[model samples]
Target: MLELIAIFAAAASGDVDQVKSVQQRDEDIVVTGQRTEGSDDYGVSEQRTATRLPLSQKETPQSVSVVTRAQIQDFQLNSVNEVLATVPGVSVLAAETDRFYYSARGFEITTFQIDGIGQPFAFGIQTGSLDTSFFDRIEVVRGAPGLLSFTGNPSAVVNYVRKRPYREFHTTASAQYGSFNNLRLDSDVSVPLTADGSVRARAVGSVLDTDSHLDRYHLTRWTGYGIVEADLGPNTIVSAGYGHQDHDTDNAQWGAVPLLYGDGTRFDFARNSNTGQPWSGWGVIDRQIFGDLTHQFGNGWSAKVSVLRRAIDEDNELFYVYGNPSRTAPEGINAATGEGVFSYPGKFVGPTRNLTIDAYVNGKVSLGGRSHDVMFGIQRGAERYRQDAAYDFGQIGVAIPLSQLFAGTFPRPPFRRSTACTSSTAPRGGCPCTV
Candidate 1:
């Protein structure tokens, strides 16, 4: 477990209703404006992911949990999976070094959204790899949200609310250094870019380099993001942003070692006893460009249009060992017993591109002296996947003997260049962790 503590300072400000409340008497000016909601409460939140309506925690009719920006800073949660694990009734299954599956309500969750808009895109365990620095809050709604997300499954939905540009100028930076050659830095700055302060811009960056306790396990990662906003008029707002993240790992394990021998004799191995080939690892590079437009109508209704284009490029390789020992050869695995299997090398080199568009509107109507908020929207998403290599089944990789399992002295398998990984086959049990 990695433990870290940080000290941070924040400035708080609130925007009141547009109605000007001012009084001048005896050469003295007095102004009064009510705060947006109630007093500051960490336990309460104005959630929109549940119904696309601005409803307080007490008003929403669903089981929801909100991880606020303050909580993220206090707990030092930097990734999507770390934040989700802290939520109520959420569980994660880590099948591989890079694969993580989320489950809620006894079913694997496949529905997720950004700013309350969701697409038909199937989420992979790699969703955990997303950076959280660009978001203001994370909202999780338990149970099926077919009405809002249009997913008929009983799994839950997670929404990431992006941070908007601020007119005021503020900047914060933090750095940390720890064991195993670990070094990290995070910084963000928000500033006004116009004379009238109608346009704003914000930028955030992070860098990390760390070595794990496990032998030969090390990682290096970096992320950069920036956003700009313009207030075209009193009721129209537009914004654009770009985000990119890159990471690489060393000595990544394809699969765990065998637990017991073919004769039911268990093997006592050290924690770092890995079957990972020297050339096996994950090198991920992903980037996105997104923009959104919002217009507030004169009739108290609002509409929004959002578009995002994302691309994922990964080069990963793996080595797995598990099968029965061959009767004649001490190092060979028998096809029938399936115990002392030889090491096999495989690679995945598929890159995927995704374009998603979502639009929606929110308004209120009165009936029978009761007020109700209504919302409607449409979404379209397209994904393209390309493969550059292929895996051949008949040709097996290099094999090691069962006696050399713990000493790490066995001949490692040759690294196979990646072809098409989970990127394209994810729809067909390739990313079984996805669902």
Candidate 2:
């Protein structure tokens, strides 16, 4: 058995060298653009042209960055946010383990596209984090893309190219673990469906679990995706795909307040300051579903459409205080007690829907010894969001054990009368506790 295993390993190494030699030869073989089908040179020329179109990075008019699959693999990135952070002029602000805030060139980016089709945006609702495992490539166009993307902020646009089935068969699996007890597993497979090799399919999926730096906080996620492609007769192709993801988090806080000293200087708080306490944590759940369809015409033209829907639910509890230091205490009140204190607890549930459809035709034609590229397209999209928040102070008990009221223990009172939560309808000319 040992001798047989050694022989097999040597044969595999020899095959690797042969494969490298063939690739080197292919790279050296070049042909003219006008080659007939099945001429052995047509496929090679087409692939070379596609590779060089975007190679002259400095010559492109727009600021663009391409994140290749190799780069993603090198960085061990499982999410789009992780991959985008390596690019210049981009930032990712994580609202929570399952939610993220993306900004570029000092402005918030609201628009995202898949294979050049728009992804709708919803305000005040979480757009679940994007999975990087299913993408073949990511293209970022910086600054205003009004001419490229129909409507959006001038910051930038992100285009995700999904993995498609090729003539070959391949499969890959990976697992990773990191700080904060993070763990993830991802698998992907692509193969041909029929002997004719005209029809193909690909599937990808992932599961993740992690604990946040925040006390008593953790998150879990699952995703699945599948795509199918068919060649319907000559000079025509069709493709369709669907994807779904679910994210859940527990004991998370919306955010923490900035610390200030006597001179207004800020300080960073300890990550685990509020451990194992009631009313000090929150939870949120988010889910998303999306689909796409595309068709190609023989005459250098194609059209594509994509749609996505997302839903988010959140629950939160916060504490604040209000009152004058010199004011007299009310009946049954202890003067030794710390300054006035207040508490506000609240819940918010939101459902968001988005639909975007677009069609475009592009072609390259020679006119008077020069090639002119032309593109014409139209797009329409609608985004709607509904939020239901249950706001009331009576449900939350009165402030007691000031240390318990405030997630962090401080010398100042937990309650204070300030414009932050003050309302004009208060009976005593002071702000009442409102969530």
| Per-residue lDDT of candidate 2, residues 102-121 (tens digit) | 78888877767766667654
On the 0 to 100 scale, the lDDT of residue 76 in model 2 is: 76
In model 2, the Cα lDDT at residue 361 comes to 62
Each prediction's RMSD to truth = 9.0, 11.8
CA deviation > 4 Å runs, candidate 1 = 1-44, 119-123, 324-339, 388-397, 402-435
Compose the digit string of candidate 1's lDDT tens values, residues 1-435. 111111111111222221111111222322211121123434544777888777887888988998877777777778787899899999977766656788899988878787666744444455226667877778899988887776646878998887776677878898878888888899999899997658999999988788766667667788998999888886788889998998788676665666666776665667766655556677888888899998877444788899988888877655556554554445645555654556555665667788889899988888999988888889887777654543445445444566664344434334344334344455532432211
lDDT of each: 0.69, 0.56
How do all models score by TM-score?
0.82, 0.69
Best by TM-score: 1
Query: What is the alpha-carbon RMSD of candidate 1 to the true structure?
Result: 9.0
